[model samples]
Target: MAKTVGDFILERVQGWGVNRLFGYPGDGIGGLVAALGRNDDLEFVQARHEESAAFMACAHAKFTGEVGVCAATSGPGAIHLLNGLYDAKLDHQPVVAIVGQQSRSALGGNYQQEVDLQTLFKDVAGDYVETCMAPSQARHLIDRAFRIAKSRRTVTCVIFPNDVQEAKAVEEAPHAHGTVHTSQAYSEATVLPQEVDLERAADVLNAGKKVGILIGAGALGAADEVTKVADLLGAGVAKALLGKAALPDDLPFVTGSIGLLGTEPSDWMMQHCDTLLMVGSRFPYSEFLPETGQARGVQIDLDPTMLSIRYPMEVALAGDSARTLKALIPRLKRKEDRSWRGEIEQRIARWWREEEERAMKDAKPVNPERVFWELSSRLPENAIITADSGSSANWFARALKIRPGMKASLSGTLATMCPGLPYAAAAKFAYPDRVPIAFVGDGAMQMLGVTDLITVSKYWRDWLDPRFVVCVLSNGDLNQVTWELRAMANSPKVPKTQDVPPMSFAHYAELLGLKGITVETPEQVGPAWDAALRADRPCLIDAHVDPDTPSLPPHISFSQAGSYAEALVKGDPDESGILTQTFKRVFS
Candidate 1:
């Protein structure tokens, strides 16, 4: 008997070890979803929006080291999946998006919400293929989809036509979906750099000149090896934003992050180190980096694409960071760098203390920065935090003063939206006992199905219940980029005048069977926070923030700031007293 497309998909997913899929029920995939319903080994979770579903899938993929799956109908549903898919791609996550296409006959011309599905998605999916009339070949198609997702660590789209979804059956074994590995092949021999290159690198370290190592996310699992390399070579280490948790900042040789958002030690090392070893980092900040005349830079990456993509390197080797360091350990000669390491250490310590002081000193009504800082300080050593992209990314990155014990962090690519909630939820799912905070911005709140908040409240609740508190910085509008655009449109005429309608996200939470609290003043924030930490149910803290308050990032251009200056003076041509709120929010 020929197997139905539905049976083929189930067996294929089971074969690829995908037991859960983040998706929603709609007219497009009714047959497919129903078929999935009968499979006890697979789980189908319907999300509020396609973006949220995709995000959940991405997080699941990241945490489990497997290709996370999300499904959506064609047209609007498939469109929404792009944001998360883009995020997954940039973050190097394995994601598979199974989108239901309209009937084959209706695809070419606009019947209703028709789009050329294949053409629309080909560019987006790093790897993509469409199954036209091959219902019998569904198993192989799904298998190839999984292969693309894992090999490229990218989002792969598989468009399944609707008519053949519910045909027949196939006999399958349970073992197919039980074993899968997301880890790539890393040859040990690849670890041994050419003797000539190793000697050159070792000679520089042994020369007694100051050396520093900058690590990125690629070095996450190699912290111990990095430390071993540092110990033998007397090198100090700092990380990039993506690499913040790669090593314990408390280590005497470990400094903080680099970039404009980076700490003093990172900046100091870029300037002082005569020889720099960058492990698993593709830092594009050429301005902060020294010219070739001062310091020779070395980099080790598993992917060859990273080499010469941005800054030129004195040496670039494709190898496993941990194994490569281990191989180089014996070849490296130890050198004394007490003072060199001490200087960077002092700067890291000062930056840590200064950030704490800065957050503590800013006690005011609706200070979003202060909100982030306090949360970071109060979280336990092993707390896991997920930050949404947009204002939340900057606000949290700048304010959430992380100590060495932070266990996990997931960030969006530069300025996207809709990841914070699911990433937080997934982290909570991964480690139920740890306090997971979803630091979100109001703009992206509705985009995530709030119903998931109920899922969180039901299974994971408080200190004893494994808390998942969503702290939404509420400004009622997504002003992340538009504020700057408005400022840049024209020169100052006097402050412009505009006001967004008021919104109460807290009330929305109350309806979801979860504790909801809103704080507009600094005085009430402390207690609100305490209640959330201690609450026996999942909670949401709607923090009414000043829209004008500059996020202390993007370092708003002088032109934009001046333009904003005039916009405030005008004060909507209606509301006059609100000028103080705008100026203090942005300029201050």
Candidate 2:
């Protein structure tokens, strides 16, 4: 049989080194599905929904430095991919989404499952989104999507109409006026700032006695450079949530995550520093940073648009984080005064002790902080960790101590829910030998994680090492929002909107032929993780943690405290537990 456009599309993506495509089956994409079945070079991962598939693709790009690809049928399936694609776009992951459209002839007729896919994908895939009107258009569309996605480190789209997908393949475009030729070749440029700018940044750093370094996801590859710079300047380093794994938490001068889910040491470092250097991170909270002009600032990022957006910088270096830091290191003068670094280390040590004390405090049942804190010590070497939004993110951000070589991430800019399991699955696919763990809340588990468990069961047997674990904080409440109501809105928890229905996630995992463990007490948290890690297959730990455990910010203001008191006075449903837990956390 002669090759079709569908065949060429798959072949081209495979040529670009895409080993797997994540999507669900639908008739609109029947041609591509058939072609996929015939081809053995690419693997098709069947996700429960298009959203999960997109999340998987985004995670694939994040875990591995490759362009992630996801496919879906037209209409609702295409719409479902928007949230996950936005996650990729906002977090700056390279992902290409290929969606099927209705027959080309029926596009404007408003046929069944026909939607304006071009306009629908415009915002998320703004860098590039094109429809393949003919077989001749397939090659360039596929090539451009992958190239642009990789080059821009953002989401791109290619729409394939059902009719066009089944048309005969156009392996090469004709050498004519209207025809366009494209190549699959792409290489990352070495982005470096001018020498004058690097020297200026170094001058600002050397001038100050108290220096602070803040890094985000962009600093992932420049860990050594960041460390050398930090050590030379006798500075403290704080990680943005997305850059948690950029530096190991064991470093005394390395403060943990910064922001609402941040540590006291990081907040202190930012508040007191006279000089600040921000690398490869666009952490959105300005209040968490030093007051404008309080500190002389230098910012570094690959994307010029992101430079100096968060903080007013004296020097804005538009270049790759690693390379820029490497160039700046030599110009920097080592600070002989070790007082600032020593002070920062003392604060970090005290903060960790406080964190341990907070985690061990008694609660109604299991304390959620305890769950993550226990897991931190038991995490296998080189394990990949993913967390969902909500209270789980709060704990994952604060309690977990990410060591060197362990990879960790979540929905950073989007802060969306339900990517935990999908990300872990993608990480496992990227590195089948490494353990992948997910920390999720009951709400996210029900929304998406439960369904993705079946995806895990189906693929775990083929993995070189099958030690995937999903740790579900089964607190029967939308815990994060519930606390936000009390602390931010000055309102009591409205059980109608905030309570999550109780379900046995462990039992659900068992039903899918995976190991399941239930942990109701704090003592069982550590043992359960051990069992899950040792299990021959994927495991789910249903940890029934206390909903009243508050995720306190590093610096709580008077207004926030007053709001919490007012909410309690208004008669919260979990008033007693909240009071008890809050007292222990704050005063204990």
Best-matching candidate per TM-score: 2
Against the reference, the lDDT scores of all candidates come to 0.69, 0.93
Clashes in each model (backbone N, CA, C under 3 Å)? 13, 0
Candidate 1 lDDT trough over 10 residues, lowest sum: 179-188
Residue range 117-151, candidate 1, lDDT tens digits = 78777766857656544454565557767877776
TM-score of each: 0.84, 0.99
Tell me the spans in candidate 1 whose CA falls farther than 4 Å from its real position: 1-3, 105-113, 169-199, 204-208, 401-407, 446-466, 475-500, 546-588
Any runs in candidate 2 off by more than 4 Å, and if so which?
Answer: none
lDDT of 2 by residue, 44-123 (tens): 99999999999999999998989999999989999999999999999999999999999988988969999999999999
Give RMSD to native, each candidate. 5.3, 0.8
lDDT of 1 at 585: 40
* Residue pairs clashing, model 2: none
